[model samples]
Target chain A: MKMSGAQMICEAIIAEGIKTVFGYPGGAIMNVYDEIYKQNKFEHILTRHEQAAVHAADGYARASGEVGVAMVTSGPGFTNAVTGIATAYTDSIPLVVISGQVPLSLIGTDGFQEIDAVGISRSCTKHNYLVRTLEELPRVLKEAFYIARSGRPGPVLVDVPKDITGEIGEFFYPSEVNLPSYKPNYKGNNRQIHKAAKAILEAKKPLLYIGGGAVLSGAAEIVRELAWMTQIPAVETLMSRGVMGAKNPLLLGMLGMHGNYASNMAMSETDLVISLGARFDDRVTGKLSEFAKYADVIHVDIDPANIAKLVDVDYPIVGDIKTVVEKLIPLLKEEIRTERYQVWRDILGRYDELHPLLYNDSDEVIKPQWAIERLGELVGEQAIITSDVGQHQMWAAQFYPFDRPNQWINSGGLGTMGFGFPAAIGAKKAVPEKTVINITGDGSILMNVQELVTAAEHRIPVINVILNNHFLGMVRQWQTFFYDKRYSETDLSYQPNWKMLAEACGGIGYDVTTKEEFDAAIKDAIAQDKVAFVNVAIARLENVLPMVPSGGALYNMLLEHKEEK
Target chain B: MEAVRRVISVVVLNEAQVLARVSGLFAARGYNIESLTVAPIPETDMSRITIVTKGNKRVIEQITKQLHKLIPTFKVIEHEEMVEKELALIKFPIEESLSDIQVLCQAYNGGIANVGEKMVIGMVTDEPARVKHFIEAAKRYSPIEIVRGGVVAIER
Candidate 1:
């Protein structure tokens, strides 16, 4: 059948089973928007900013295990979306972003709204295409989704010229892709799996270091099984939160900078490290020369390049996490060594007892950690929590009891400040029945505060809980600890009336300075059917504890803050 | 133990910006690309990229693996038993004896390609190591200019 380029795009999106797309349309993409108006194949959401659109798409992808789709116009629209693209790229989220470009005739001629998007995004995106003709549009769109969702998933961008969307052509969506070069290894080698199983059984101390890849590959259940059947403890990374659940006795909490004391100690003292779908990021490794010095590392990752990029791997198994873990499960069932690791468990238990995750309780004022704990207690595992980067994010990660996979989401790798509120909107859209909340710091919340209006406009009803510390809490903590308390530009005293901002955006707002008020406000906010903001004024100058001091060894953690003279 | 030189060849679909993607990977990761050569494969919509890099065993493994991750990449060749070749063209002043330069080029498997009024261009194709030796040996002739193509290698 014959169709316009714009019709073909809509058809292709429907063919891919995409129901919702976020974007901000402009002159370059007017043709597509016109077709979007004419078709009911999918819902097009108009976000306030291009960046938020991309972030919403990313959040949708991360939470639903599907490829999130977004569209934007040329020039500044594409440039604005770059940060969100990079955020998804760093965390390996499956996302497809379609950006409009100037017509083919105006390309490279410095046409208005013309930018070298494909060139700028080449390094960040997993793959990209700039469609020159209408005939290639269908294929490019099909490949974009395939590449975005397969083999260590990452964002893919497709740049379509304005003219291409108007050109008429025959539409044919390929049922399957035949790219010989893009095959992803889904099964692990039997010999390697056997060797790993044997090592797991023989080792006196073995730790399961799980990362986001496990969640991305839907291997969390299998990983949990491996840990349970082998009677081995596990440590989750920042991105891999909720993989082992909050209540599992074998789960060692998060492991890295700001990780639990016992988890870091266990990592330092383990004999064998079974890395599941996790890269040894610098933030996690902390003093690579000393990290896991006593351990023989077995890394199972789909991306072979990540196996030994920063750290040496003794046994490198390149395949999907679920498939590899499944192969090792039966082999591990043969021998259950519960007593062998008793000593290691005792040591780790003592470490946990020595310094359990704690904070000073203040009745006169609100502690950020207490607020997070209270929120978690109220919501339990029912709400899907998203957070922006800062002290608040770490507090939430530390205090929240997350037992569900994909329950806790945040900008872990890129640490983008403005990701939370918009991401919560996306997550809410992905799972409408689940309550969505954005745990944000005062400094990070305002970065995407405009999204409150997006929520109100769309009636997303995502709650934004702002821990108002009146400063960039993380940097101020650093300045207090390392620098001589010369706060510099870290102070954010000039703040808006969050209540008024929410009210003006057609949402509910509450300003609370005490615990009682916070509890009341959160409960009230959750019950409301509109976008709600609960601004809880927390103690300023608070810091994320158990710090590794950047490049220090994981074991060399500062458990408490000391007033430096 | 030490950083040694390795030659890597990658087969990639011929497309605009493919070179940028390949080179960008090296630049972003701080991998050293000592020499790089790219040309379209004959009668196919694909290109072959030959790169000479210096890294230890670990870094070399990472480099090859990273290359394979690129979407257009068809295959990455990093084999020890490989045959390598390079080409060099040297321009010498007309005053220098053409026979002497031709003898030097013959030793490296080449001869004079052009003899102009002002200069004589001598071409040579040989193993990369011998080409380096020839370039050094031709310096005694006081060549006007020297241009060396990057190494291209194939499995033996």
Candidate 2:
């Protein structure tokens, strides 16, 4: 059927099984918006800001594992979506970002409402295409979705010129993408796999370091089985939080700058480090050379470029983490030698017993850590917890013990402040039967607060727990330590009442000041059967403890509330 | 510990100063991609760049992180995991026997790869490391025309 480029874009989305899209209409994208109006096939969410629309779409993608689609116009509309696109890119979340552009004739001529979106978003997307012809619409959309969901997963952008969208074309969604340059290596070389297994078997003390790719590749069970069979204790990165149940004896908790002492120590001491689906970010390896100095590393990641990028690997296996682990599991002998396991366990247990997370106070305001811990206890291991960036995010990461893979979605690499709200929406949408809570800071929530409207419109009841400290707590904490408590611009004074904001967005909202109030508000929010926000006023001066100073070693962490004059 | 280094070749468009854009990408991302060599393809308006970088798997992935985003970037293939070859011509002493040098050149796939006059041109199309090793081996047979072609990659 002949259709305009804008109509074809929408049709491509529908063909790809997208039931809803989040976006705001603007000058350059008016045609696409108009086309959206004619089609009742897909629901288009009108957001207060372009940023919120992109974030909402990002949330949808994370939850559904389908490509989250968002549409925005030129200039500011496209610019606003940059942060969300970067967030999705850094976390390897699949997203399809469609932005309208000024006409081809007007491009590079300082045209009205025009900005070089392809240029601006170049660093933040997997691949980007500027559709110059209506005939190219279907192919661009197909490639965009293919690139977004394939190999390590990231955001792809298709910038359609406004005039092109009105041009006629015969639309057809190709069942396959034949990009010669885009073939991703999914199987490890047999020699590399053998070398990895040999290294694992020969080492006296081996550590299995897993990351978000484990969950992305569905290798959580295989990771656990490998650890169990090899007698290696496993340490997870922040993105891989729920890959292994926290209660498992072999699980050594998160390993990074903010990771537990045991995990960090295990990483430092292990003779053989078998890292699966995890990049060696500077956060995880304080001083790259010093990190795993004693270890002969066997790095396995689906992205081939990530194999020897950070810490050097003795054996590099490039393939899907699940595939590599599945292959390696049978190659090694399963003779259970409990000696190395007991030694590591004893060390980790001692550290856990020594520097246990503690909070001492009888303050009227509810402690954010305690609130998160209670939520973890109340929801048990079934709930998916998403968080925004701040002190609250750190607390949730520390206190919430996830028992399954793909739970605890948060912005890790990019550290985007407002990711929690939209991510929760996506998680809730993906698994509607399971409870999803967005534990966000007041500063972070305000960044993408408009997503509440999307949640309300879709009837996705994602409970948002706002840790209202009236400050960008993390920055404020940094100022307190480094700037001699001047309090700079971190304090957010003129904040709207969250309850009123939620009400205006057509969702339930509650104000909680104490532990009892927080518990009651949570109960109420959970029972509302609608998108709800529980705003709990938390201590403003609170800091995320065990912070490894930038460029400092992992062992050199500054504990919270340390003894002082 | 001393840092290890690997040389990488990137093929790109040879247009209005695209070298800066490629170099800027590496610089802005804090990726120290060392010793970059960019020159136009003999016939076409495309440039091939060879960059020497130091990293493990993670670092290399991060270096090429945004390469695909460049508008003019048609493709990015890391030559380390592919079948690659580079050609070099060296002018040696005329007294040196052609047969002896040809035997050595044949062993490195340089004999038939290329041939010239006073300069016994040899071509070695192997892995980048093997190419480097071949270049080092050719250095012993001193002749003049020492020119090396930019690296190109093709997956096996």
Candidate 3:
């Protein structure tokens, strides 16, 4: 029964059914790392940086549907993990990050490598704790996990002082957490469900607005069924990429800036929007005053604060999306199904055909869209795709045929640049049998290029497909449009030889110029047993089109590029 | 739905950073907090925080929901029938008309609290709107310094 705080941490992790964690060791957290070294209960991935560790844990959580665990030491380590924590926080990913702090006696004296981490991360984290005593360690650990994986999941941080980890304690991990202030509603009210069902029955042109909350709550099957049963067309947000599946007939694709014409038009025309686990973010609501202007909204989310925060809702239901959808499913009669929405679907389908996502493909010089489409074809439904934020990310979202929940993982809210490679590594680790790929840009890949060595060391076999445009394509597109081609510091033409860089990092590398070479490189990369990087050269001046031009109405989209004097 | 002043009472666990967490949400979201008061509840390890802010019905609903979302917060009450009070202390020059100032303070349910050689300090506890009026009226006495406490509210 008597154990050191370090042992208690290990015991608690085991008790929580955590099989792996990601972290980088430091002076303050040495004792915990020592305990990690002694325990064989969980695997600890030693990342190149503290940031990547948290991101890898986030990816693991996203891919596995389990609460991710990560640890790092004080000061710089804690600060480095802030972006990853914020990224997970914004996306509602469940994560518990353990941060080692300075000794209790040396905390406020401005000792070496000491920062008010709990204070700094207070706003970003769902909840946080500064562990002062060894006795409360077990309970804190339990509550941290419980709060992280509960309703409207998010990242939680626990700052453990160095002295506390070294002190002896009696370890007792609680099976259940009982916080008087924290109880999440999981069931929808019957009357509200009835009201929503009635609204759906009356809505002739209803649209299903799906977001990451649906993905997080595992409401994909129910949502897809609801869309089909109700004959409602669906549109996905960036975070909810695969929830509606790429092949669904009712799916209008992503709806926002850079979203397809059909989806945006459908959003503009729909009479009712059933918002399942989706917050009406500014990006989704291009111009707030005109967004879904004629629509009655039924916003259902686990978080009460999200409902009507930006857009007013006619029917607001605060509960788990899956549970609420399940309750509402039984209320709908077969008579609710009719051909009333057929005309609406036809209108959207016509829009899709009129302004389809198009790009000119060349055999000599590979286009990013073509490359992503080819990659999607080669890596079918079985692969998990992660992408960094940029032109390539948008392309992947546009092209990848993700057919299931959690099949596509990316930083949606934070849009962290260096997210793809480490996330792919974590996804591969979570599901070793499945192939994992990071579709990255030349700029984003370099941000976390050091993690290539981590993947190589573990032989994670995560393929990094670089869409090498030699420039920040998204920013260049903006500069070309708004700034009159005054491209300031957006060019990365003078870059490292990626092949040599990958070779140096203990991974196989390929320099792909033509479409044939790109295809060959990807197939060969997947065939390899080690980490592989395929640097494919894409067209330099390509832009992600169908933009709303910031603060413009969603329906007012610039379909393609035009030369203007 | 027009912008109007609303008072909300939030009960939260007494912890080191609970106040920071509660206030940080408002600061981060650009929500306005006009006045805030915090004091521990008797015989319990909990504190009641009263916040007065200006928002429309939607914004006030969001603020209350956000406050309720905090892990340490136990209850958030936006009472329809409530009694609100604010305290204001004003220091006046000793040469001012003491009788007139005392009468004015009494009109606002208060009186002079201290008489020092250099100044006279008057205190008043009244409704927040009346407290505003009392401060404005005391300005005529050429007060040396004035301090106003945050509003605290309770359901009637």
- Candidate 2 lDDT over A46-165, as tens digits, reads 767777777778777766668899999999999999998998889898899999999989988999888888777767887677787777789879989988887889998889899999
* lDDT over C-alpha atoms for residue A90 of model 2: 90
Scanning candidate 3 chain A in windows of ten residues, the lowest lDDT window is: A556-565
Q: Which lDDT value does model 3 have at A380?
A: 72
Better of 2 and 3 by DockQ: 3
- Give the chain A TM-score for each candidate: 0.99, 0.95, 0.99
Residue by residue across B1-156, what tens digits does model 3's lDDT show?
699889999999998889999899899988899999999999999999999999899889989999999999999999779988999999999999999999999999999999999999999999999998998998889989999999999999
Cα RMSD, model 3: 1.4
TM-score for each predicted model, relative to the true structure = 0.98, 0.83, 0.98
Q: In what order do the candidates fall by TM-score, top score first? A: 1, 3, 2
* lDDT tens per residue, model 3, A77-131: 9999999999999999999999999999999999999999999999889999999
lDDT of 1 by residue, A99-166 (tens): 99999999999999999999999888999999999988999999999999999999999999999999
Cα error, candidate 1, residue A342 (Å): 2.1
Q: Roughly what TM-score does model 2 have, to 2 decimal places?
A: 0.83
